[model samples]
Target chain A: MNWLAVKLPVLVTLGGIFAVLLIASLTVHLLQRRSPGKSYGELRSRVRSWWVMVGVFSLAMVLNRNISLVFFAFMSFLALKEYFSLIPTRRADRRVLFWAYLAIPLQYYWVAQAWYGMFIIFIPVYAFLFLPMRMVTIGETRDFLKAAGTIHWGLMTLVFSLSHLAFLLVLPGAEDKAAGGPGLVLFLVLLTESNDVAQYVWGKSLGRRKIIPKVSPNKTWAGFLGGVATTTALAVGLAPWLTPMDLEHAAMAGLLIGISGFVGDVVVSALKRDLGVKDSGALIPGHGGVLDRIDSLTYTAPLFFHFIRYLYF
Target chain B: MVRLLRFLFFAVLVRLVVLVVLGLNVRRREWLPKAGPALIAANHNSHLDTLVLMSLLPLEMLPRLRPVAAMDYFLGNRLLAWFALHIIGIIPLSRRPQRGSDPLAGCAEALERGDILLLFPEGSRGEPERLARFKTGIAHLTERFPQVPVTPVFLHGLGKALPKGEGLLVPFFCDVFVGEALHWEGDRAGFMAGLERATARLADEGRFPSWD
Candidate 1:
């Protein structure tokens, strides 16, 4: 009687997702074994946790239309926290950073409420003024320039950059779709994270030439090219389900995220080097920390969000 | 609340600026035995000495290490005074040589409370590259609080970082050398001699320029 409830479409989508994740996990596991110098044994547990995160997010996407925006908003907050912790900011900047933290909820709320015009100005123009004014009021007069610089940089990197994810969710025409934003969240998540995972995998396998010797020693030409290619292929395959695009558009999106993610990783790495810290914190298991995982997303999320908004919205 | 805010504000400012300019070099840091009263007898080098030590130690250990600062100097400016009293939790000592207002009493109280007090035995800023004579106040401190182990500390390059009577901060690498705690028997003369030996040892260690 309820055979329709478990239709081919639902079963097929679920089965396909399970199979993909299973294969990815197994590949990473085997990759770990083959690799001589591994980062940590706890990496296996982290990969398992990633599987759980993907599974839960995928289920949430299918179950509700509104939840996807909330999901990405939470992810943005974690990423931003990781960012601020790793980057060194002065005391005079704390008040401004407190205000910047306020931006997280407001930006996400704009997405949840579907308010477009406000989120746009909230970071660029409004935060720009408010932060500097905060520093000026402190009356230290000495080191005022440094204070201002710290505030502005922290705001731009953590709040303004992360607001893009929310921007993606509220991208018009994404509403009332059967695919529930047409698997846009899933597509973005997969491409960004897969770029990271694939790069690490390939780099470990055959990474002889260092891409940027100073910034990230582990990053290699082999890893970068391999990751971009594999992610592009995945994007092409998932295009029909995720977007109203053919293979070409998906490939372009993957490329955009892949390149931007690489830049993001380098930028955050530079910050870590400046602070003389290895990991932002030891909050995550195999991954260095939340910052290590989301370094790519800090740049990629906003870039991809804007690209989608411009082309499709 | 204003004072607390100011203290936090200045602390963060110094931490941030130092992070950029000097660059922290905390390779291996360890706290002393957590249970007992301890005295960290450091040399008076520069303004950056306290900051260097604070940054080097883990936050868990920071609350216990109270840097002893002069009430007249640190408390002279209202902002610095607030930071010293509230944020840094420095044990304030009067520079005026009055006897009743025993500066070491505060250190004793802190020790009784099971807190670690950082005392600069040189009493005032000296050429950090050279060891200044051990001030009598530490001898007096040990004679009174004989139970607490006097930990000798020497700060290298802090004089270059923020030299004596300097307004501008000099950017340079500084090292905070913490020697093993000095053992004190119940005898006062023995404790004083032990403190001197520990101080000399730390000064010698500071003389060795950091390879880093």
Candidate 2:
């Protein structure tokens, strides 16, 4: 058995997360009591939901490696499901949606095999080509272009991009400084999620200028910069035990996740606006749906993976 | 023993499918009664409707929950009849009531036992996700017992998933909207209209993946 992967740093990193969640819970509870209204009530539920989300995530990480892969694949499935439910598809593409879903496991299989080449191109190159070809065979010309673009885009955002998280689990380095791939996954997730929270808090407290008023009205320059700085500092602090990156490189990775996380988030916001919905669905209480929670990760995972891959590997 | 089988099959197996494989997005679930002596009127599209509703409540409520289904169809043969009666606990309401016999008798008895009666007012499954004309049975039953709460539920995605003549279960996310519980509005036409209006409101709430 390899003792390197399952060691003390994993526990320490998890403990640190738990401590931060505890403070958040207590703070939110206090805020709710001090100023009980709709917003604070929502904040309370959001914090409560965080506990369950983190609990499930931590359990998956501590389990067998295959379990970890399955967990990520399941998340991909949920995000894809939410995306499909929200969008309107042509009658012809409905059957093609099944093929899109079937690709989830095949995409994850590449991750499990540690075949980076095939994993990178399976959805973008192969799925991109094959989905349209299958639709052509289905004999549907009406709205063919629109159908092809939306289906392939859904697969890329929900399955292909998110699969990078699982692929990080199979990546060959970070075994010594961090608790292998789980640590890197943890680092990316923790920084990204906390960045979201930090931005919300900063915007609510001191936001004066809207970053992208049309796309996401709630986003502010104050929040954006504040979140990036906080995440960068956090990354530098947490990189020693959870990542192989030194302080300088860790800060760079932090900037990458922070900026791309914002872009990913706003893109989902644009999607919801187009669909005329406040939230995607009601799967997660306080957090609209699986898609809502994983939107930022859809970008952060892939960008951070390649960043680490280029620098470390 | 059979009760245990039903409970395990639903609490474990059916719930696994509903929760993971087939996602369920329900609105206003608190409107459902924890105990029975109530009627749950929903639109039926697939056989999965019964299972999806069963999965919503706690498992202990299974014994008292009865779906008022067609007798000849659900209990056509010994094997299916046995499964329906023992495992599903459906009240066998004969679609064609015998002369001078009450079709609603079984349902009334189930309600008298403080059971939750799941009724499909549309009488039978129609096209998936499309509402069909509602039968007057629900109104007649409610008029006979005006006090019982009838929860109007609108189900989507199941019909698309496992509609009639379809064997493969498409894993589409189902939307269940539990409308405000209504009561008998004195007359059959008025009550039927109210039921239609309530279900229509719920149907509009769902963003169904229909090709327009």
Candidate 3:
């Protein structure tokens, strides 16, 4: 119980975030009410959901040291479900999705168990061998290429890539270390989410040039650069409190998270383009289903986790 | 209600994202103009067809325009079930032969209330963009409500965006050509024959891409 009280710094940090979000929401409401144009009632609703999600994640950081991996694994399951629903698979694809569903809990279990060697290769190696073998036994030929591609891509993006975050949980650190290991997870999440907010704010305000006209027309270079700058500054500022990384390393981490997050967003945009339907499901208000919210994390998790593992683990 | 709207808003956001990514140009064919209590009869080619039709309509017309959808599909979930029935004001019909009910009553009620109704005479999804044989339900509707105008809309390109069994959205611009409203005259067979001819003519124009 004393250890819980000892975590006041982390608690206050999160409280500060809530206070900022509250002020921002009030500002958006006031501006919308006073402005001449119609209020973006939908956009405001989405921002409110973002506030809840950020608060929940921040509170988890204060509640326990080990909840990060569990929290992310749950997110991975939701994201994978959204991905598979949008991308149609054959009846034969059911066998593949079954393997995928099993892989979700197993991969997370590995994280909980802290089996580094097995967790690293569970999908790329073991499940890779196991899933294809299951598919081959089914002996269906129609759209086999598509079936394989869809299942493999689903696993790679949702399970294999996301598991890296869980793998980050067990990385070796000095026994007496205060700001490392679990703290790294907080650092990554903050940078990624902040980048999203910064990009949306800048894009809506000063966006003129489309970043990628074909895939995501609303994305602007102004937004991207603004996001990168803000996230980089945040990472640099928070590194000492959250990780063993120096200023240079923290900047690099932020750079990687921001760039990779943008790339992930573009990739999902292409996927949705391939699937004519928008949003995976309507579970979250203001945000699309679980998939739309975590699309950036699909790419960022693997990259960020590995960077930390290589440098510190 | 706000929560449901929030979910719908995100759904729209996802669609907008896909539309922007794929460059989907949603143009509505206003051949019949904004006539009151009209019936929109279009070929059922793909799932995206309904959304495209709804998107192409004027925003003001959304609350007034009711799309007739299958009961099994639209009524699968509770919230969507409510939205389909009450919010979007969709008219649900049962396709199962075992069940026989006055599906047209809902349509009739809406038309009597002076709201436009969109009905797919095919009653099911098909691969080709061509019109399938018209179900007797449409004929039944016309016979009951002789005053309501039936506008035939030919939409080209949505079949490519979301083909049956394919989940990914392909970017494509489509044109919807609205034909003159056809009224129910004395002869049932002749009225259907005329309806078939109009649809076939639009299909053969070949200016509209076939669902390949």
Candidate 4:
């Protein structure tokens, strides 16, 4: 069997996850032993959920291409569901939502078929026109602008942005093909997730000036810069092994992911604030919801996918 | 055997559709009685409301939990009647009464036998987010069975998920707010008003405050 082709990266990623989990387990154990409060309880649960998330992700990647694509597609579906659940919509926009959901499989089908043109324009162009046209037929114009805008924005962020991760798996060429497309996905996920962790650690230790207290109270400039610096260094080190990028481009990708990751987090925060919700939903045990966990990726995935495509592909 | 079949179908198959397809999150489950005879009343917004409420009950309660569906609407066809009678175990209440037949008789018998009954006091599906005037049947039932507890349930987002006359089932996050069981000993008018007020409170709880 040619399973070794996929096995190496899976093993390496699993090893890295084990090391991180061990360190986190020790850290939480020690910190909570002294403090023992709500934050400690949340941290412990978050770490525990990470193990399950990592297991699901690894199994998808190891199984084959189809399973991995389906996994990410399902994630996009969930994130979109959460987004719609929280957002206000007019009674007229009901049918528009059906079309919006219909776009998920069509978009992912393009990814599966490796039809780049359709995948890129399906939501932005076709769905952009189609959703409004469909809403117009429903004959409710009271909240036309707001309703249409809300549906389009949801499709853009939840479906279009997240689909890029699945699209990454099908990028053509020898290097990515040899490395297995999952490596690129794993690379992006690892860096984005690490950036989140780094920011949290940095913010707790050194955060002073709030970046945007109105939007997200906890985010600070110190955490943002510290996370960017650390993530860039890791990206540069891991680029040769995982991605096809040179050191310079990898560093650039890291910087892009780190900054945009924060943007994604706060943007979702702004949405939640506007809607007056603490978390999107209680889907994930400690992470709040699927949207909370993948908020960073909503921005990073599309940007990084296009960046690599522009430079390397 | 039939009860077990109904339990498996609704608890497993129907619950899967409500949870996975509809993405409903039942809140304040503690408000629902774990067992016994209580009239579970909710505001009707869509056909999906009955299914969503049915999915929230404990599996063991399914055999005894009878959702009071309209005989004309759900039993319009033989196939639907069979599914409603056999699978859902509905106590089909006739909207328009025929001579010599009591619509409330069946419901009363079920409650008297210690079976939990789910009723939609709104009579039929109304517009999303707005409550229709509740019918007086609930007050009559509560008066007859004064010992039975009437729990008000407010369903949020089912109207949008599968509103009236919409064929497509759009997946949205729906919340089932099960409120405390209300008991009343007064005139039918007063009792009906109290039930309506209770449902309105649950509805307010379901809605996001204007500032929010």
Candidate 5:
């Protein structure tokens, strides 16, 4: 509570986000009142979901630290579960999945304790080795390699990658000197998600050239470049208030998130394409699933965490 | 009272497990019958299927909702039988009724009273996440009351969450797809065929990733 009360910038940033969402809500409502057709239904759901998502996320960010950690861990669990559901898994390794899920809480536990040594290598090193051994105990070696690879890959993508966000909350300088850990997290997440939207809007309106048509047909060079520019400018604008970085460094961080956010989005598109599904699951109304919503965070969380750690921390 | 216990079991315990432990992604909920004289025939993968389906209906229907379970399996002892029959409100069907006794008499009576019967046509839990051959019991029950609408439901992921023999209940997200209801068109064979098709169609609608 003291952390939130002490930081004016953190409160201001959260308030600004709600204000922007309020405007978006107003815009969507006005359009719907004017048209009142089926076209606005999807827009209405999307806007409504945005309200809930932002509300939940901001509340978690400002609450107790343990609750915040648990929130992120639950998101990781959803992403991991979605990945498990999407991929074709060998039945022999059904029990092996328990270990995969067990890694989530343990990994987050390390983050909570700020034990970087264990957090850095727990999934990639320990779980990576333990999963195969656990599978071999079942004595089915036909598709052992594939099963092992898929499970570990999901853990890395969903659990290990996303845990970095929670870890960012406990960084050395995260407590007092600047906008605080929540600010850094909010900066990364806000920029990454906005970058995703910026790219989609840019590509939808003025996308003429597809960057990688095979992987993601919706993505275009215009969207990619435009998203990067917008995100970069936002990073520059937000850094001084929400982060410890100056304008130049914020722009650099923005460029990283903008480009990496697109990469992460298309990377998941490649996954869904290979698996031959439209979206991941039907958890959220307009959004496909937890995995669909956090795909960019999977990439940006780790990238931005390491970027800040390497530069300032 | 027994009714209070049953209400607490479903309204509190079962709802907690389903909503908290196993997040449900229920589809076509509007297709679910809001009233009685209906049958919800879901594919049996895990024991949780009965509880999950029962929780989907309105809590007020707890008095009228009954799950058709095996007599020998659910009622091996007096204490267990009491809990299953009263708390769970299960209409136990003796798989082997001695000397020409009408085993399905309880089910028919329950249906006659306009109770919503939760039945697993597959008879028992089979291989996890795999559809087993449905026994003729569903057809027999439906034939007795042709007007009772049987809603075919397909449940996914619960088998892996807690399967037939597995005691460990891992948290896995489950999906429930409710399909259009069917009625007895002709004989037991035709009605059975329709039930099979309805269930299989709902299963395909699940669109699970092809299991390796």
Candidate 6:
């Protein structure tokens, strides 16, 4: 193992995360020093939680490839578990759920083995067919359509989509093949997360026109545009160090992450609205749940992975 | 020896596996008394219902919690009977009437001894999403031991986790909503109906919330 090659990107990513957190803390504290409202405390706690998240992620990246794979796999497990907990299923779909849970490990194992063909289609094609087949064999036809749909949606969002992060780590190319996989994963996560924050910040500062008031009242056009602009600039600036892509492709990737991240966030909001819950779970102190934190990645990871694969690989 | 084994098997192993596998998210746990002689009455959905309830309680209460399981089902097999008897310490109540023994007698004795007993007032597992008419057995016990508080617990999604007659267990999320405890007022039918209503209210809470 080339220790310096791995350590360089990992250290740079960690340093970047520290600088962002420090600046965010200072800015939020300054903005709220005069009239500290609920947002002040919330932003403080959110920054605190980000420290833990960044620490753990950096540790995983620095350790080994397998460790990072397992970390992402565990993340998918938590997200899927939260999804299932929120959604209602018919009794007939019980056995089918087992099959759904089983897909997480099998999908990640393919990523570990670098089997791209199986990784891409395992959940969508195979699990989709197998889940309904398992439900049909149970002989409880009542609400069969709803049951199968719920499980398939969960598998798609939680396992199949999230697996793209791990898949990105295994892509074969000149740069990505040279242990640049972790850097790409870090780059994608950093841009997506920063975009989410930029939207929230800009939305609160200058947001007027609601984008979709019914589904998510907090989302606004100002937030969307500001977030896209900021994230696109960051993507281009950090492309050389953190990703295999150049300025133009990195800018494209930025737009994709920004837009899809908003979509994923709103989609999860819609789900919570339908289910009538505030947050998915209370695992994270400020983030509400693992799902709440990673909702944007559900879309960005898969989309960015494919984009990278198509262009570079 | 039995206590240690029960802690190891039921409290530690079974609870961890069940919580992870079923993805159980227990709500309104504050309704469950931290330490008291309360009768926990929940709607039966699957074999996992009891396990889910047990997993949610404080570990200290596990040894004292005696889930009233069906003698014909849990105790029919020797291995299961041993585990239920020794590890889970279930108070087996035979559905079939014996020659002279009263099924409620064991429950009353456990309550008198200050053990928290989990009773499925529905008598047997019913179809998922449907609550069977609760039998008078809970009413009888509550009447006999009026001091014991009957807390209504509604289990949602266990049926989908391990429904009746399913050999394999499914990994689904199950929510346990704990409601307020009811003290008997010397009315059997009214008390039973009130318990059922309380459980149904919790079911609604689990299915949908008043606010998003």
Candidate 2 lDDT, A1-313, residue by residue in tens: 3533355677788888899899999988787677765367677788789899999998888876788899999999988888887787775566688899999999999989999899999998999999999998989898889889888889999999999999888887556546688889999999989889888888999899999999999999999999999999999988888888999999999899889999999999999999888898888889989989999999999999999999887
Which candidate number has the best DockQ? 5
Alpha carbon RMSD to native, model 1: 9.9
Measured by lDDT, the strongest candidate is 5
Per-residue CA lDDT of candidate 4, range A120-231, in tens? Answer: 9999999999988998888888878988898899899999999999988888872344255777888899999999999988999999999999999999999999999999
**Local lDDT at A75 for model 5:** 89
Question: Which of candidates 2 and 3 reaches a greater lDDT?
Answer: 2
Point out where model 4 deviates above 4 Å: A1-5, A22-39, A174-178, B1-8, B98-102, B184-194, B207-212
Q: For candidate 2, lDDT tens digit of each residue in B1-212?
A: 88789888888899999988899988888999778799999999999999999888888888899988989898999999999998888988877888998899888777788899999988888776679999998888888889899999999888766777766676778899999999887899999999999999999887665553
lDDT, candidates in the order shown: 0.67, 0.87, 0.72, 0.85, 0.88, 0.82
Model 6's chain B yields a TM-score of 0.92
* lDDT at B167, model 2: 68
Give me the displacement of residue A84 in model 2, in angstroms: 1.1
Model 2 regions lying over 4 Å from their true place: A1-5, A33-39, B76-78, B96-100, B207-209
For residues A1-313, what per-residue lDDT tens digits would candidate 5 score against the true structure? 4655226787788889899999999998898788776478777788889899999988888876788899999889888988887788876777898889899999999999999999999999999999999988898989778889989989999999999999988887677757888889889999999999999899999999999999998899999999999999999999999888878889999999998998899899999999888889878889888888999998999999999999888
Model 2, residue A62: what's the lDDT? 80
DockQ of 5: 0.62
Query: What DockQ values do the models have?
Result: 0.04, 0.56, 0.04, 0.37, 0.62, 0.26
Ordered list by TM-score, greatest first: 5, 2, 4, 6, 3, 1
Instruction: Report fnat in order of the candidates.
Output: 0.00, 0.57, 0.00, 0.38, 0.51, 0.35
Q: Model 5: which residue pairs collide?
A: none
Q: Give RMSD to native, each candidate.
A: 9.9, 2.3, 10.3, 3.0, 1.7, 3.9
Candidate 5 lDDT tens digits, B114-196: 89999998888888888888888888888888888989999998897888898888777799999998878869998888878
Model 1 lDDT, residue A211, Cα: 95
When 5 and 6 are scored with lDDT, the better candidate is: 5
Q: Write candidate 1's Cα lDDT for B77-177 as tens digits.
A: 99988768777778898878586766677877888888877777777886645667666777677767766777666666566555676565544445555
